[model samples]
Target: MSILKKHPERDPGTAEAVGGEELLVTGGHTFKTLTDKVSGIVEQKPPAQWWLIFVMAVSGMLLLVGVIGWLAWEGTGIWGLNNPVGWGWAIVNFVFWVGIGHAGTLISAILFLLRQQWRTAINRFAEAMTIFAVITALVFPGIHVGRIWLAYYMFPIPNQMLIWPNFRSPLLWDIFAVGTYFTVSTLFWYVGLIPDLATLRDRATNVRKKVLGFFALGWRGGNRQWQHYEKAYLMLAGLATPLVLSVHSVVATDFATSLVPGWHTTIFPPYFVAGAVFSGFGMVMTLALIARKIYGLEDIITVNHLEKMNKIILVTGSMVGYAYMTEFFIAWYSQNEFEVFAFVNRAFGPYAWAYWIMFLCNVITPQIFWFKKLRRSIPVMFVASIFVNIGMWFERFVITVTSLSRDYLPSSWDYFSPSIWDILTFVGSFGLFFTFFLLFLRFLPMVALSEVKGVLPEADPHFYHQKEGDTK
Candidate 1:
């Protein structure tokens, strides 16, 4: 088998599955058929749908480019941002997309560490989401600075004043956090592509495909090469796991470090992480649903996969809900009137609608997962995912707005609304996200062709047993 010949460590670090005598390999070395499966992809392409994705992606790109052009020409005066409501959708969108990026990492890294094989099927596309979402996210903060050219200041550079980025500042932390995440995630995705590229290398018939595929780094199924590759992958995976925690922790510090009552809280770090995974899963669900339908990847994507993700949503949803309750309790128990009023006004005051909507969507809607049937149903899952996305968006909205609205000075209090640009740009962000993702779907393997094959029963099911029954 070429897989074992090319890759080393069949079932990399796989232990014997329960009641089974075989050791399963996960790193593609064990799955010789991986390349064959991946190469078979284009054969399954629906010409009509592929064209549709192309058209939508092009349209989205136009919206993103057009919006940026308009914003650049008109200046920051075009936004709804004001004195107390200084941070508007731009920041909210930044945090929102960044938070959405977390699901990919969790699925790829955390789930892998826990040996959840189901993750393999969706990890590729989800990682793509992480990349594009981060890209869209990066745009907001860079532009939020008003002078787009000065965005370089976020990074420390050699200058006449010898100005260096401040490590103590949360904003500076964001630059490093986001940069590291993007770089590491990209490396992880590409490195995992080697053998698959080789598969393409072997299967490609045209001069262009052969040349491009070969340059994907001449990879023959060499055991030694696989050993080194597996080591690097594991090492990177280990490194990436902590980066996931730290990056979002740093993002939360942006608000928590501030003196504002609603913003100032130690729970922010974990809260943000939970919300990030929550929203990210919602996004993955959104994409996976469409991808499965259009690409006809049902057998690989599976209903069980959706259910597993739903269970995670339920868990994270509860964690986020607990965060809300804990935050309120702490605010009241702290005996601080500013914090007390901030929490009170958010609930029973002018923004009560947002608060209730957030509660109902986040806290109430996820309860549908209690029924196993609903969790696995595609339509139900889609609806629940939409609810989570709305809830998570409102989660950011509530945090940013409630904190900034009624500050210590009552006279400075004001309710903010999004401008036309703000609303369109927000909508256009989805276009940007989908645009990048749709391209990945068409040009690249939407599924981790090699990785998934490695986890298939033929490769060494003994290695990737996510449950005891899989031991067989």
Candidate 2:
């Protein structure tokens, strides 16, 4: 029997199916159970695994800090930059991290706008992921400018000499684009947290209560407060929706506007946007699986939720694969030698290995999701998500390294290799990302309790009448 039919009071939305559709939340949870389950993660002492992972994540973050310091002190020469390949893993890492942040905003903003209630289960941490990924991404560009001290020049601050940033430069565009995206995403995340914070506040004692209360902004859960809260959330969601498209499109512009054969393509914006979403969803899937398992949130973060995410990964992966094929077709059709060479070299040249790895991961791995059995399987989806993340990172590497490594002249051509520092920097970035994520899991309500409650049958006015009628 459907959980809803078994427990007539449970409203699992209006979607109908043979067995009355799958429940988004299982285990016969009432609103109280839901709240207690999510809040308990914060209130209780973390498990040993949490402490182990936290220590490792902190180590990685410290390594990242140390590497950045070394880079600043010694200079960019420590990296493997050569004649033609001015860009290296730094830019690749930058783009990769930025793409990682995309899934969070897409989940929180776009899905919310579409009224995807399932999003409520995962949106909180996904939004947090966006914030941390952006923080990690912002680190690269600042240090990539070579002169760490002169990084201020990237900003549009008026000076005594009347010097200004080049408005036309795409690199300059990243500063404003990512900065605005971070600001809005942070606000949206914090706004969503207020009601949950109030819940924590009411339940806490001593310092915890005071801290939660301060962040809760004196929320009384009154009708007037809820009305204002809804309006603000709607406004923020509307604002962030366009950014879901625009931020990555602007990032793509960094490549599209360049005259480099592979980078200079009209198709880049949409292609990059699609790839970003694909990659972002992959990371979210990976984290969600881990979080769900560790916290024993099988009911809240159900297979139904994962299957939906896998479906998105499949769609976006197809789009990404289409973009890949279209790039080659355009290269061949245009009859441009440099462009053709760029695409050809990506497949057959020295870096062809990276290209194929990307192809396998981005194009082939997600194909498994076509089988409903595989998509819903926990292990299969977990591995596939990891592959997607790997493939997307290689996609950036292939684009950045291949095109730059082989330029217009053979004399300027050189193989771009990452030094030990490069590899460490990249690995350490995960430390930074996960450190923040672990802290978020420990201290905050990882699930949006208020939003989740809103989707319950109990939230529906007619639900009680229906239950009463059935009882009669």
Candidate 3:
């Protein structure tokens, strides 16, 4: 019998029932009549749906192959880059992707330390997003080097040239920042994945499961495994918190340390960090919202979870707003003529339209969260998350182009425009992000099944349902 039927005399939707008592919610509805709705949203699909994801994965791989083929065939000229604007779209894409990468670590590591219980439901996907986004971002810099073969030059070693990369250089800092963050984030994610993978392994009855099982590292969720997992998890959380901040801060240095007018501000560290989390959370919100709807995981991703993330959007978003203000203030205060011009130019520059669009998306749209009703409303949050992501892309653009277009001299100023290839590659990157995510959803349990089911009080089978009759 359903929980509602057991307590037919009690009212529904109360605080103690939802929060304190922590019980599964079963409305006065039967599974027979709701089969279509439940199956459409929840309860794994037939074999056909999985095949669609497999097709998408293959297509995504072809796109990468095509991009590499084109990049190799045309050389660097296919991209939009000139003497002054040499960095162009590739670096912009890199920075944007890295910013998007921060969301996972912030959500999983920082929130975990704060002891936010709601995180247990969503952290797995958020961490996965971080790892994938980093993988995507790392590709750009390597390919941007063009040779694609000698890309290893970015590293320093004991042999060969005996010369080291400039440690003081911002670009070198990027290598450390991105490399360390990716390594740490990957470990954190895989560790958390071990037990769940073991769960899937146990549930599997075929050779495919056997292959995936080997990667499960022989996890059994025994007392020993749990103890080691807990300590390792906590240590990783500690290592990652500072690493997350440092990675993006150093990424900001790629622009901040530069003497260029718009990019030279000291505020880039915090500003970039805020923008990263803002975008990362936006992407997380985008994925999480869809995962809940399409997979019927509402029990795990409650409205409260949505509400809390929206609040985070509001908070980090406000920090980004303050950073924007500080950048303009510092520019004017510095009394540097070029610096002053950069700020003025961005507001009324050729890219001013893009600039304001970013402002509306990043600064204005998230303010809706201040209202209780809007935050809990899924539709509202989904649209807002999309806007935040758009605004973040523009933030990178305003930084890259505004500075590149104009510097110390007017004659050197040039308008940077992306060629057709630039646009295609950008779109293709989205395809790549989504395709991998779709595979992640179809396989490996999108909502972290073992983790989510664990959170329900019924999982205990004791406290929440005492002596059968007492639960009523």
The TM-score between candidate 1 and the true structure equals 0.89
Give all candidate RMSDs, comma-separated: 5.4, 3.7, 5.1
Clashes in candidate 3: how many? 0
> Model 3: how far is 176 from its true place, Å?
1.9
Those runs of model 2 whose alpha carbons end farther than 4 Å from true positions after fitting are 1-21, 470-472
Q: Between 2 and 3, whose lDDT is larger?
A: 2
Question: Which model is ahead, 1 or 2, in terms of TM-score?
Answer: 2
Put the candidates in TM-score order, highest first. Answer: 2, 1, 3
**lDDT string, candidate 1, 1-472, tens digits:** 1233333343433444444533233333334444444456653564587678767767766887787788888788788888899998898999999999999998888887887888888998898899999998998988888778777888888876688888899999899999999999989888876776666667666884777576678787688988998889788889889999898899999999999998899999999999899999998998899888876577678788888899999999989999999999999999999999999999988888999999988889888899988998999999989999999999899899888988999999999888998887887888888778876776666777767766655455443343333423
Roughly what TM-score does model 2 have, to 2 decimal places? 0.95
Q: Give the best candidate by TM-score.
A: 2
The alpha-carbon deviation from the true structure for residue 205 of candidate 3, after best TM-score superposition, in angstroms, is 1.2
Give me the displacement of residue 288 in model 1, in angstroms. 1.0
The candidate with the higher lDDT, 1 or 3, is 1
Per-residue lDDT for 196 in model 3? 69
lDDT of 2 by residue, 28-141 (tens): 777888889999999999988899999999999999999989999999999988878898988999999999999999999899889898999999999999999999999899
TM-score list, all predictions: 0.89, 0.95, 0.87
